[model samples]
Target: MPAARESLLDAAYAALMRRPWSAVRMVDVAVSAGVSRQTLYNEFGSKDGLARALVRREADGYLAGVERALGSAAGPRDRLTATAEWTAGAARENVLVRAMLTGCWTERLPAPPLAPVPSCTAVPAQRRADGPLPTPRDFVRMVRDRAVTVLAGPGASPADTAELLRTCELVVRLALSCVAAPPGEGGMAELVRAVLPRHLV
Candidate 1:
């Protein structure tokens, strides 16, 4: 069900875009995914399971984008700028992403249980999803740590690395603000650059 699992997730997302999560039918999702309703159940035990898996994937996707931003060829400051910009952009475009970053789940979305549920499913992916989803604080730490790891590099003293961590946290926290009120024109890059230490390389 590897391929089918992905297809189901894709269909679930597409269905979500068309209507609220409450209105998204499992049978419809299965039809759109080209898999049987039973297959959808096998992949995700229930709609709540599907929501958890979807939220988990969205969180992973957000972090994946953060990695891409950090991996850019630009210098340290510019790279941080890119990370901030991506954070803001992702939240703006994806309601699920916005909910993940802000912890503001509206009635239209599925606010799945954040804690681990008793899942009997044998699917590893679903098991992982059954576990706690990242909180907004968790997302902040994750993005900050990734930025620090990529930018700090080897040979740096522990003290400098600590300062870098603070800078990364600052950028991430500021970027999260965009979920409510986005920055103008320059997106978050300008603000990130302004806060970043001039000596960052």
Candidate 2:
């Protein structure tokens, strides 16, 4: 079922890339995945449900990239730079990610509710998908909190926690700004490094 679920999502994404979301048929997605329409419905419940799951998957992937960037072996500032780079890169590469970060859902994309939708499904993945989706502000806060957690690791002084959080927010917001209006030749990494202080927690 997990494999089928992924295959369906892949097909749905491919279809979405080719046409507007409103025109993307559930049957087409199921056929592209080589699965029955009933299987698709059983898995996602409805087209809107599928949209939520796909959007949720994109958000998860972007956050996973953020974690990887944050966990890099580089210095604290470098790691923050990496995280910022990841944020900008993810937004640029994936329209769904860009929409999630910028809160700009074009007519071609599905705009699922940021608030949680009621869930009656027994499927674990769909249930989680039906949970509250992160808004753009939530993404900023999420990235900031993750950066603070990674940098101020394990019994670090509480005194600098406030400063650290502020710095993290700056880094996250700067990255988002770059997504909207890309920086000049300096690129995201240099811009991130320049903006982040020499002392990163």
TM-scores of the models, in the given order? 0.95, 0.95
For candidate 1, the per-residue lDDT at 176 reads 81
Model 1 misplacement above 4 A: none
Number of clashing residue pairs, candidate 2 = 0
* Cα lDDT tens digits for candidate 1, 116-151: 899899999999999988988999999999898899
RMSD of 1: 1.4
Model 1 misses residue 123 by how many Å? Answer: 1.0
CA lDDT, every model vs. true structure? 0.90, 0.91
Worst-scoring 10-residue span by lDDT in model 2 = 192-201
Could you say which candidate leads in lDDT?
2
